[model samples]
Target: MLIVEELHMLLLRPDGRVESAVSGNRLYGEVAAVLVDLALHGRISFSHEKHPTVDIVLTEPTGNPILDTTLQRLVPMRGKRLQSLVVSPKLDPLEVVVESLVVQGVLVRGERGFFGWGSERTPESDPAPELVLRSRLAAVLAGTGAPTQADLSLLSILQNLNAARAILRAECGDISARDLKKRIEQLTAGSPAGDAVAKAVNDAIAAAMVAIMTPVIVAATIT
Candidate 1:
């Protein structure tokens, strides 16, 4: 519970203001608990276990020393080495931060074209619309039923119009899952990313099905 709360405080808010995390001028145990939960959930994974450090880079460069310092202290307490990266319209803070984390053994950089700590070339700026769409889709697909990030990311590889529609229908299911699967196979043909997208859609559907199957626990369980 503490880890859960700490993560809530550390994450950025839409309004750009640090909320309940600042309360009492001390990071509560609850906050730390929340972050741990996040780590377990796979939203974040151990990049490098050797250094035991975490890095928080500032790309905007406005310089919020208080926030930065608070995060630095808060993260190390949770067990990690910390570093900061600064990026701008011209500066690649993300790259710098990722590199530092990789060096410190806090993160495992990804392959040639992937999202994570390390990459040979910088990625293009993704628009908010794309981010929001991906997020919504991801929410509709997660948990045990959730595919590994690799399977879920296949949507990016598709560029053709028909193929995209087929994949969307299969995952979304306007009528039947079987029908959608059939259509997807028909559209996929020989495309490399097709299998990936198909896997993603299946995972997405499986994730949603699990959500529906799960029961909410409102009361404490006693041994």
Candidate 2:
């Protein structure tokens, strides 16, 4: 399963509904994961061509049509900042990722009608994936042992959502929030990527997501 899917499932409840709207954080964070995964798999490479710009360039066809298409889109963005490339209107990576989950069995489709006129087919995560994923994350957060690469990736997504508190409280022992925060710090500090570019890209994406979410957060607070 993709790390991003696991994160989505975690935010999903047993009743087949997401706890929050499809926020910018979740949307862009998943896109960032796909980009980073492709980079780690050697399908792409990231470099700074000029000041304050990290460009993603495809190295080879990844064989996955969606990823390959995204790679093609990146080719023209040779020297653009990663943030700009992420928000490019030409692509909606979140739709691609969520559709993949729906195409798989992890999420199921249902219909909903609003205002008595409009209906939409929405998908929500299956409980099974979230159950297993949450258990695994809970164990790791409790310091049961060292985390695997997948675990590290999961940490990145959940962290970006600022869902650590909910995750720790719901999935694990009666640990303090501080402890949960510390454990996440420990895990990310030891993220097994071993590639500086991947780490930098991940950090940049997380930062960008934070910026994207901040306005939404404030508007919600004010309302």
| Leading candidate by TM-score | 2
Worst 10 residues of 1 by lDDT: 82-91
lDDT of 2 at 141: 80
Tens-place lDDT digits, model 2, residues 1-223: 6554565566555545455543334556556666666666666666644223545554578776557766777677666776665556554454555566778767766665565454334455555776677778777887776676667766655665566676446764776767766777777787656446445555666667667768989999999
Runs off by more than 4 Å, candidate 1: 1-177, 188-190, 194-205, 216-223
- Candidate 1, residues 115-172, lDDT tens digits: the string is 5343243222223432444454434332223333332223222211112233343335
Error of 1 at 24 (Å): 37
Residue 7's lDDT within candidate 2 is 58
Best by lDDT: 2
Stretches of model 2 off by over 4 angstroms after superposition = 21-24, 48-59, 87-91, 113-126, 195-198, 213-223
Candidate 1: give its CA RMSD in angstroms. Answer: 17.9
